[model samples]
Structure formats: structure tokens, C-alpha cells
Target chain A: MLLYTIYLVAIVAEAMSGAIMGMRRGMDLFGICMIGTVTALGGGTVRDVLLGHYPLGWIAHPEYLLFTIGAAVVTAFVARYLHHLRAVFLLVDGLGLVAFCVIGCDIAMSAKMHPAIVVLAGMITGVFGGLLRDILCNQIPLVLQREVYATVALFTGSLYVGLLYFKVDSSVAQLASIGAGFLFRFLALHFEWRLPNFNGDRIRGFE
Target chain B: MLLYTIYLVAIVAEAMSGAIMGMRRGMDLFGICMIGTVTALGGGTVRDVLLGHYPLGWIAHPEYLLFTIGAAVVTAFVARYLHHLRAVFLLVDGLGLVAFCVIGCDIAMSAKMHPAIVVLAGMITGVFGGLLRDILCNQIPLVLQREVYATVALFTGSLYVGLLYFKVDSSVAQLASIGAGFLFRFLALHFEWRLPNFNGDRIRGFE
Candidate 1:
């Protein structure tokens, strides 16, 4: 139940972020809705597809699509005011990251997948939607470029999996993992933390 | 038997094309291989997942993975030479497009999907691997931007389905559809046929 609530908040925030990107690209209303929906749901869709979990999350629950589209249309109309609320959306997006990671890990674990795959699944679920959005908008993905975001998902998922392995109560494990992930992302953003790039020449050559 | 043979040729050509793009982006060997594999198999992977078909094509047939990766690596070493043979590759890519469309339609029909969706399935199978490739490489999808590319798949798929509906011999329908799609694409290329864009100002506002 707690997880579901947080997931809702995260998806809405992500959808709005996607809409802002679409507006930046001057995409049509149709394009804005397309990007927004992909941003809000693409990660879960990819995760579900990878895990072979049938009846995809959005397909099964059409209301999520409505919620995402509604958020996007509202964002399109009010984009000018969005600059003022950057901090608030960042906070929400951070929370959503952790929630998405936890839920992803939980789902993978329930499937009895390898522990390594479970953690990877969590990270993919937390980050791939934004990656898809950036790709569609013709930009390098921020998760791949910037600080500690995908790492936060990986860490939280591993922690949750560890706690469960140690017979920790599920509720305690969930809260602790979420708290740690949120703090990690918040600090990374505040301090402008970044993963060290490989020597510039090699990094540029590959990236 | 004919379909399988054509499918093999198509995947190899697509994989090589993906490798060329990777080289243009100055990507390392891993990136080249990743892009190539995605270009070769991504469409089929996406189609099966959307249809809730388990054991993705590449996973079920590891040999395809090996084949795509091999093609990509070869292209990386021969990218300079690829430009000299652009016409040849273009011809091969066109054939592959039709093969992919036909197979996609066949699979969807076998599953007893809606007729409209079957056509869509064919288009997705024919075009999405390239879409995924372009997205990962950070470009607007050519299928969406170019002349008469995706349209060929749509026409071919619809024709195949129509023929099948009228109880045309499966072999005859397949051959005719493939021939029609190939000819349509060839003519479009030769004539520089393009779907008309919306008025520039209005398109800029929305597209």
C-alpha cells in the first residue's frame, strides 16, 4: 500500500518532467502526450517485458495512462511557471526513484530471479523511462551522464534484497531502503556529485 | 523455409547498418556490438514482448545473437568500405524490411490477433529495430522522418493480410507482398518520394 502511493507520486512527477522536455523540443500535443506516457510508464513496461510478466502494468491499469496524460497536458499549459517549482519536483522525483527501485526489486525477487538480475532490474525500472524520454528528445540520457542517480537505485535494491535475506521485516526493509535512496540522491544533487569519467579521450571515444 | 532464409539475410544487413552508425558515433567495440545486436533483434524482441510471447527470439536462438554480433564487429572494421557499397546495402536493407513485415504479420495472424493489429505488428517488426538503434545512437528516427519507408511495411502487411483473407495460397501471398513492398520502396527511393510535411510553422509548433 505504501509502495503503491509512492509509485503514484513518482509517476506523476516523471510524467510532468517528460512534458517539460517535449515542450523544450516544441513537440506537438500528440508528441507531448507520447513522451509523457513513455516517461511515466516506459521503465515499468520495459521491466515487465524483460521479466516476461504478462499484462503490463499500464495495460492492466488504464487509469495510470489517464493520470500521466492529464499530468502532461497540465504541464504543457503551465510550463512557464515550472521554473519556479524546480526544487519541489526534484524532491518528488527523488522519492519516486527510490519507490520505483524498491518495487522493481520486489517484483524481480518474487519471480525468483538471480539476486544480481533483481538489483539490475530495480535500476532499469528507476532509470530507463527517463532514458527513453531523453532518447526521444534527441539528448544524451541524464542518468548516464550525471551524478549518482542509477547508483542510488542499485544501492537501494541491493540493500532491500540483503535485508530480506537476513530475515528483516518487509516494512522495515522498505522504509530503510527508501530513506537511504532518497538521501543519496538528494545529497548527490545538492553537492553536484558525479562519477569520475574515464580519461577524457577514451570516455569521449566510447560515449 | 523461404521466410527463414530471408529473415536471416535481413537481420545480418540490419546488424551491419547498426554497426556503421556506431562507428560514425565513435563508439567503442562494446557500443558497436550493443547497437548492432539491438538493430538486428530489437524489433522482434519488442513484438514478442508486446504480444506476451515468452522466450524472446534472440534468447531462444542464441545463434542469432552470435550472428548479429559478428556482423557488427565486421562492420566496425569495414565501415570505410561500407560507404562505397551504399547501393548494395540499401538494396539488402529494403529486402529485409519486407521480410520482417511479412514475418511479423504471419506471427500476429497465427496468434489470431485483430486484423488491424496484425498489420501494426508487421510495421513494428519491420521498423522498430531501426528505431531502437537510432534512439540509442541519439538521432530522430529515420522511419518517422523519411520517404515512404514505414509506409511500405504498412502497405505490404495490409496486402498480405487481405490476400490471406481471400484464401490466397500462403506462398503466393508472401511472394507477392514481398515483391510489392520491395518495388514500392525501390521506386520511392529512386523518385525521392516523401510524405508531405505539414506547413512549416504549424509543424514546428507541434512536431
Candidate 2:
């Protein structure tokens, strides 16, 4: 019940973020809703599809679509005042990122995926929604170039797996991984931490 | 057998195209191979995932990855000299597009999807690979803004569905649809056909 509640809140938060981006791009209302829904659910959808998990989450429970679409619509109507809640938005987003990673890792582990793949699936679930959003917005993925956003996902997923391997209780492992991951993401943001930004400008040929 | 042969050639051609785009973006060898593979296989993968079809084509036939990656590597090495084959390349691409649409339609039909969904699937199969390529390259998808490339796919799919609905022989339907679709694409390219590009800048709000 707690995870389900977090998942709902997460989708709503993700949808609003996506809607904001769409508005910035001058997209129509339909495009905004589409981007929002995709941003909220696209990562998990991709993970499930890759693992051959049937009946995608949103498809099986169509109501998730309603939540995302509704959030986007609300964001579109009230975006100008949203800056006041930027801190709250970011915090929720951090929580959601870890929650998503944990959920993704659990799915892969249940399916008996390779350990590396389980971690990778969790990272995909955590970061790929934004990746998909960026693609739709016609931009390079921010996570690919920005601070340690995906790194947080990878860390959370690996930790969750590691804890489970050590025979940690399921709920405790989930909460601990999520808590640590959220802190990491928050600190990364606070300190403006980053990985190397590869510059291919000097690289010659093949072009 | 003919369709399978065409599919192989198509993936090779698509991979080369994606490699060229990646090269222009100054991506390294790994990036080039990734873009190439994604461009070649992404369309069908997306189609199958959306339709809940498992054991994806490339997964089932891992050799397809070999063809796409090999093509990409070859392109990266010899791209400077490839300009001379522009006409031939374009012809092959057009043929491939139609073939892909037909194959996609057949799969969706066998799955008992709605006729409209089948046609849409065909169009998605023809276009989404290139769309994914552009996304990786961090640009607006060319097909989304360019001439009637996707239009050709839509036309071909609708025609293929209609032919089948009329109970035409399967082989005849395939050939007829491919031929017509290829012609349509060729003419669209030659004549610079396009759909309306809505200018959303003037439309206020949401941002």
C-alpha cells in the first residue's frame, strides 16, 4: 500500500514536470498531455517490454493514464504559479526516482534477471522517463549530460540488490535503498556534482 | 523469403543512415553502432512492445544485430566515398520502408488488432526507427518536419489493410502494397511533398 501510494504520487509529480517542459516548447494541450503521460510511464513501460513482461502497467490499469493526464492538464492551467513549489517538486522527484529504481529492481529480480541487468533495469526505470521526455522535446537527454541523476538510480538499484542478497527484510531493504538514494540525489543537486562531460569537438573523422 | 531478404537489406541500409547521422554529430564508434542498431531495429521493437508481442525479432535472431553493427562500422570507415551511391541508396531505402510497413501490418493483423491499429502499426514500423535516430542525435525528427516520408507509410499500410480485407491472395497483396508504397515514397521525394506544419508560436498560453 505504501509503495502503491508513492507510485501514484510519483507519476503525478513526473507528469507535472513533463507538462512544464512541453509548455516551454510551445506545444499544444494534446501534446502536453501526451508528453506528460509518456514521461510518467515511459520508463517502466520500456523496462517491462525489454523483460517481456506482459500487459504493461498503464495498459493493465488504465487509471494511471488518468492520473498523468490529469496532472498535465492542471499544470498547463496553473504553471505560472508553480515556481513557489519548486523545492517541494524537486524533493518529491528525488523520492520518486529512488522509488522507481526500487520497483524496477524488484521486477527484474523476480524475473530472475542477471544482477547487472537488474541494476541496469532499475536505472532505466529511474532515468529513462526523463530521457524519453527529452527525446520528445527534441533535446539531448539532460541526465546523460547533467549531474549524477542516473548515478543515483544505479546506486539505488545496486544497493537494493545487495541488501536483498544479504537477506534484508523486503520492506526494510526497499526503504533503506530509497532513503539512501534520495539523499544521494539531493546532495548531488545541492553540490552540483557531475560526471565528465565528454567533448567530441576535437575528435576528427567518421564525419 | 523475399520479404526476409528485403528486411535484411533494409536493416543494413537503415544502420548506415543512422551511422552517418551519428558521425555528423561527432559520436564515437560505440555511439555510432548504438545509433545504427537503434535506427535499424527500433521501429519493429517499438511495434512489438506496444502490441505485447514478445521474443522480439532481433532477440530471436541475434544475427540481425551483427548485420546492423557491421553495416554501421563499414559506413563509419567508408562514408566519404558513399556520396556516389546516393541514388541507389535512396531507392533501396524507399523499397525497405514499404516492405517494413507490410511486415508490420501482417504481424498486427495476425494479432487481431483493429484495422486502423494495424495500419498505424505499419506506419510506426516504417518511421519510428528514423525518429529514434534523430532523438539520439538530439534533433527534431526529420520525418516529423520533412516531406511525406511518414505519409507514404500510412498510405501503404491503409492500402495493404484494404487489400487484405477484400480477401486478396497474401503474396499478391504483399507485392502490390510494396510496389505502390515504394512508388508513392519515390514520387513524394521527387516532388517534395509535405503535410501542414502547424506554427504553434503564435498560439498563446500553456507556457
Candidate 3:
């Protein structure tokens, strides 16, 4: 139940970010709504499908879609006066990243997936939606670029796995993971931290 | 074997389109390569995941990734002198769309999905990569705005289902579906055909 609540909040935050970005780009209301829906649901939908979960969460529960639409509408009306709200969006995004990472690990564990796969799943869940949003918006994803974003999620997943190894309370473990992820991401952004870019000669190697 | 060959060709065409588009957007070589890989693999990846296929195609066979990179390099060098290659891109995209639609339906049928669901899957496969590319390029998806694009795929899917119902050979059905879809799409584009927009007043209590 707690995880579901966090997921709901993350969805709203994602939708708000997408709507604001779309409006800034001068997209029509329908286009803004589409981006908001896609941003909010894209990662979870991908995770669910990859995990073989049928009738994905948003499709099974129409309320999620409705909530995203509501978020988009709210963002559309408020965006004009929120020109300086980048920090707010960033903060919300941080919380969303943490929540999603924890939830992803929890879901993978429930599905009896390997710990390594769970950690990877957590990172993908936490970051892929923003990646999709940036791709759609014609911008380089911040997670893939100028920030210690994906690494924070990875660390959080590690914490979750560590807690599991020690037989910690599941709820406590989840909270710790979320807190660690949120703090790491927040500090990284505050300090303008980023991963080093590779300047190696091998152009075809994976990063 | 034939389906795999068609899929390979579609991937190459998609990679070419992505590389050309990326160069036109002034992206670097790495960016063009990444875009090309995503464009080539995104739709099939989604289809496979949704159909519960494990170890995604590109993940299972990294050769596809190498092929995409090669195509991107070729496109990057060739696109410099092909500023008037819009017609070529359209033709390639049309062929890719038809091939993907047929393969999508075949995969869905193999998975024992309902014919209606298979048709929807085919349409999704046909358009999803282009949708992703348009979103990445910050352009509205032509599939959504251009009427009859999805309809064409659906029509082809219906033909495939019909052929199967009559005990036609699978290869023959696939070829007929591809030809029908490509021709329908081409005619629609040439004639500037469109679906009529909803003109009725928004109905209350309907989402």
C-alpha cells in the first residue's frame, strides 16, 4: 500500500514535469497531455511488460491515467507563473527517483528475480521515464548526461540488497533505500556533481 | 528465416532514417549512432517484451547493434549530399512499416493472442518506432496526426487473419499483408487522405 502511494506521487510528479516542458515548447493541450501520460507511465509500463506482468498497472487501474491527466491540466494552468520552479521540479523528481527505485526493487524481489537483475531493474525503473521524456522533448536526458543520477539509483538498490541480506524489516529497508537515493541525488544536484565523460579512443565501446 | 530477413532490412532502413535525422538535427556522430540504434530496435523491443519474450532480441544477439552502428556510419557520410532525400526516407519507412506490421502479427499469432489483439499489436509495431523518433526530434508524430496510418496497418492485419482463416501459406499471407499495407499507406500519402476530426460538442460524463 505504501509503495502504491509512492508510485502515485511519482506519477503525478512525472506528469507535471512533462506538462510544463510541453507547454514551454508550445505544444497544444492534447500534445501536452500525451507527453504527461507517456512520461508518467512509460518506465513502469516497460518494467511491467518486461517482467511479464499482464494488463499493465495504468491499464488495469484507469485512475492512474486520470490522475496524470489531472496533473497535466494543473500544470498547464500554473506553469505561466512557475517560471522559476525548476528547483521545485528537480526536488519532486528526486523524490520520484527514490520512490521508483525502491518500488522497482521490491517488485523484482516479489517476482523472485535475481538480486543483480533487481538492482538493474530498479535503476531502469527510476531513470527510463525521464530518459523517454527527454528523448521525446528533443533534449539529452539529464540522467545520461550532466549528473550523478543513475548512480544514485544504483546505490539505493545496493542498500536495498544489503538490507535484505541482513534480514532487515522490508518497510524499513524500503524507506532507507528511498532516503539514500533522495539524499544522494539532491546533494549531487546541489553541488553540480556529474560522472566523468570518457575521452578514450574507442568510439564503439559501451559507456 | 524469411521473417528474420525482413526484420533485418526494416532495422537497417530505420537506422538510416535515424542517422539522417540526427545529422539534420546537428547531433554528433555518437548521438547519431545512439539514435539510429534506438530507432531500429525500439519498436521490436517493445513488441517482444509485451509478448513476454525473454532476453530481448538485441540483448540476445548483439549483432543487430553492430549492424545499426554500421548503418549509422553509412548514413552519416551519405546524408551530407542527400538533403533532398525526403522521398527516399518515406519509401524506406513505408517498407519498414509494412514488414514490421506483418512480423508483429506473426509473432502475436505464434503467442496465441486473439486476432483483435494481434491486429492492435501489428499497428503498434508499425508506428511505435516512428513515434519514438518524432518525439525525440520534438515533432508531433505523423502517425497520430495523419489519419489512416494506423488504419492501414489494421487493414493489413485483417487481411493476414483472413488468409490464415482460409488456410493460406504463412509466407504468402505475410507478403500480401505487407504489399497491402504499403500500397494503402502510399495511396493515402499521395492523395492527402485523412480521417474526419470529431466536430461534435464534447460529451459530458465521457472521458
DockQ, every prediction: 0.12, 0.13, 0.08
Please report, in order, the local distance difference test score of every candidate based on alpha carbons.
0.85, 0.87, 0.78
Report the Cα RMSD per candidate. Answer: 6.9, 7.1, 8.5
lDDT of 2 at A130: 89
Error at A34, model 2, angstroms: 2.3
Q: Judged by DockQ cut-offs, is candidate 1 incorrect, acceptable, medium or high? A: incorrect
lDDT of 2 by residue, A101-206 (tens): 9999988888877676688679879888988998899876676455778788989999999999999999999999999999999999899887543244433342
Give the clashing residue pairs of candidate 3, or none: A136-B135
Q: How much TM-score does chain B earn in each model? A: 0.96, 0.97, 0.87
Tens digits of lDDT, candidate 2, B20-100: 777667665655766788899999989998997776777566688889989988887777777777777788889889999
Q: Model 1: per-residue lDDT, tens digit, B15-117?
A: 9999889888989999999999999899888888887876778888899988899999998887887788999899999999999999999887877777866
Candidate 1 C-alpha lDDT tens digits along A83-167: 7788888889999988998988988888999999999889989999999988887877888877888988988999999998999
Q: State in Å the error of residue A103, model 3.
A: 0.8
Clashing pairs in 1: A28-B206
Order of candidate numbers by DockQ, starting with the best? 2, 1, 3
Model 2 reaches an interface RMSD of: 6.0
- Across residues B12-44, which tens digit of lDDT does each residue of candidate 3 receive? 889998888888888899989988988888877
